[model samples]
Target chain A: MDEPIQNKKVDTPQDNSDVITMRHIAKSFGDNAILKDINMDLHKGENLVILGKSGTGKSVTIKLIVNLLEYDKGELKVFGDEVKDLSEQELKKLRTRVGFLFQSAALYDSMTVRENLEFPLKRILKIKDEKELEDRIKEVLDSVGLPDAIDKMPSELSGGMRKRIGLARTIILKPEIMLYDEPTTGLDPITSKEISELIMSMQEKFKISSIIITHDIACAKITANRMMVMDKGEFVAEGTFEELENSSDDFIKSFFKL
Target chain B: MANAPAASYKGILEEAGNQVLFMFRFFRNIFRFDFEWEEFIRQCYMIGYKSFPLVGITGFIIGFVITLQSEPTMKAFGAESFIPKMVAISLIREICPVVIALICAGKISSGIGAELGSMQVSEQIDAMEVSGANPVQYLVVTRILACIIMIPLLTLMADALGFAGSYLGVNLSNHVSPQLFFSKAFSSVEFGDLLPAFFKTIFFGFAIGFIGCYKGYNSNRGTESVGIAANSAVVNASLWIIVIDGIAVQLTNALGY
Candidate 1:
């Protein structure tokens, strides 16, 4: 218990090309196929959304990118580094640059919002200066439009507010790539729209590439620069919001329908 | 119906393997880069401090009832005067520590399991992993280390209460001053009797924390798994407590306890 921790210092340089690339990505659970031979790419400063029905592996795709879920077969690269090939130290460095927002917001329920936001800061960035840490917390909270909710608990917030706080926690470290799983699921239409707009605002403000997996067309339409509609384990369509909306494919039309 | 046992057998084997791996990972993480001091203290408060009342009550009842029930038999043999000595030896050497551990397996282990399971199910564990903060160090190491520190402390407290309860039980039928009773109690108890038992509680602590963390941290992603993790944590931790007690007793005996 008295042993001091040996800090393993790590740093990965920023790149200008594709932030994430996947080819023939596949994952399965038992005998069921979740993602099958999927290929995708997210270039720098792009917002890519994968729209799919429930149980269609939308969340699985994003989880795979972060190495939270291992792909049965595929090559997944984030920031041009093969995800499967990265060492533990490299993976940790990669994760610090690519923030993931869980579907449930996944706030540390025990910690107040301030502590929750401070978690990644203290543990990951190892930020020691109190003034800089507080300033970062304030800035992220303000950007998410919940500056007053800093001292509040996640349990005290509504669904939308929790999502905003979740995003704030994710972005406080200023990651170059963000992965959002169902950013606006289970919210009212108005709140959903607000979250979609917030995602776009974060993209524009931080200039971070993001992969948002959602079922809500409103979310995709509002936030996605390009969208991929998934069916079964494969993407059935890929285009801009308007292109996918105007496409005659019945599968794509089903998602676009009100 | 035929496949049920086979499936269950496979499930048990899988769980055992996972638990072993979890234990290894826990040890590996503990000696790694950083320790979560804040979280560890918080877990100490949650696991150790919060568990006192229940473990205390359980230990007391155990000591009192064991003394009370064995009275007739001891008196039949005209050995009534040995009650305090007998109770003290049994309580300090085995009964109090084991019973308190089982009680903790129920209280502390289950709570750890449910908490970690819910965290796993809700993706908080994954979120922590992706955030570049070690969840194993933060969550598992903290909880386990808290138990390692706390279970002995709890066992020591429970042993004291058990002696007190036995004193109260002893006085119910016959008048004996606390001084006389403790003097008789301490007459038969040596450092040998206390040391092995006290030592075993550390393993009891490890068993409870490790099993609970294993069940919960490896739990599948479902709400049902939370309940499953908590329930399995208690069952497995209690089992491990007995197993560890057996091993500790054998080792102590080899050392001439």
Candidate 2:
């Protein structure tokens, strides 16, 4: 498959300063080193796609960015605050500004779609009024193009619809940065394209910076402003899609071959 | 290739040992009250309030059946008048708390284990941490608190219902009135029997919730681990309840209760 067009800059409403930066981040589970001395920068209003084969620490990197997984050694900054030193109260405040779409959608099975969307808003943001909560829920649902499915259970939604709802829930708080992990993994090709389109629309509409982690070359091509290829828990190459395609690195060449 | 089976068995045993160690660590964390008070309240609601009907029903049935069954047995010794005493002692000191623990082990333990297991498998727990929610405080404390509060309340309700059932059961064969039955039941139940029994249930509730939450929260691997967590939570909690109850019985006996 050919690489998607590389658009360096598209005019958007949000600022384009550095949104997230990691310096020498290292994480290990017991003796198993999952990430090692990793460094990366994610700019605001940019969709940076991280491409790696399975178990290459792609998901772990996303976790670290959100401060979900602690790094044994290294500094991580989100919107200028050092994430490691922040207290629990401070972290909850920081988390509200960031949105994440989990790979499995991670929608609470016991909750309805509306409750799922309302959960963080009510629990974390403490949005109490019924009228405003309903309005915000409808607004996010409409943005994700699923306004009518608010009363439905998660089990009732199709794979693609669930992913969209997950995306909607992530954006309900209007986070400044969106981290999507394998957003298109289990979808049909057409559904995958729809998800990609939705990602683009979100970027355009919200102008939020995004970090999408996936093994899908097609997804990386369509969604990324900048792309990084990872191998064995380390970044092997990084650039615009065109720049990476033209590189002499055998792994990058072969990765893009299919 | 020839050594694969032997190696796999060894690996399984090692994994089992590690799981036991993990359980010990979880106990340590619970004693430290790892999560916040608000989180504890939420878990109490989940474990206790949500499980009221099942626990209530179990308590009622056990009380009724024990009364009916003991009627025939006591009649053989012309001790049919002692039915209330027997039912009261059994419910307050043994059956009520133990049954509630077992029921909770089934309901709350499995529910917590499955909930946490799914959270772990689905990575919501991870998401919480990433989003700056303290997963430990958010998940662990709420559940532990729920167990502590709910278990005692459930036992209290169960104790009442069981006595009612025993009264009804006694009426089935004999003419013992509700008033006479309660009086006889109370006369046999001193503070010694009631205090230790009720007190031990708090620990029972705590054990079930803590072990279940611990199992589920730490669960990894894949879908199968969730089942393992649920299973282990119930097994460990029930075992601990029995062991703890036995110790309480011994201590009470030594203290001349």
User: Which 10 successive residues of model 1 chain A have the least lDDT summed?
Assistant: A1-10
Q: lDDT per prediction?
A: 0.89, 0.83
Give candidate 1's whole-model lDDT.
Answer: 0.89
* Stretches > 4 Å off in candidate 2: A1-16, B1-77, B132-142, B164-179, B250-257
Best-fitting candidate, scored by DockQ: 1
Alpha carbon lDDT of residue A205, candidate 1?
99
Per residue, candidate 1 scores C-alpha lDDT tens digits across A160-181 of 9999999999999899999999
- Of the true interface contacts, each candidate retains a share of 0.95, 0.47
What does candidate 1's lDDT look like per residue over B75-148, in tens digits?
A: 99999889999998898888888988999999999999999999999889998999999999999999999998
- A30, model 1: CA deviation in Å? 1.9
> Each candidate's iRMS in angstroms?
0.5, 2.0
Candidate 1 segments exceeding 4 Å error? A1-16, B1-10
Point out the worst 10-residue segment of candidate 2 chain B by lDDT.
B26-35
What lDDT tens digits, residue by residue, belong to model 2 across residues A74-177? 77778766778777666777788889999988887667999888877766667889999999999999998999899999999999999999898888888889
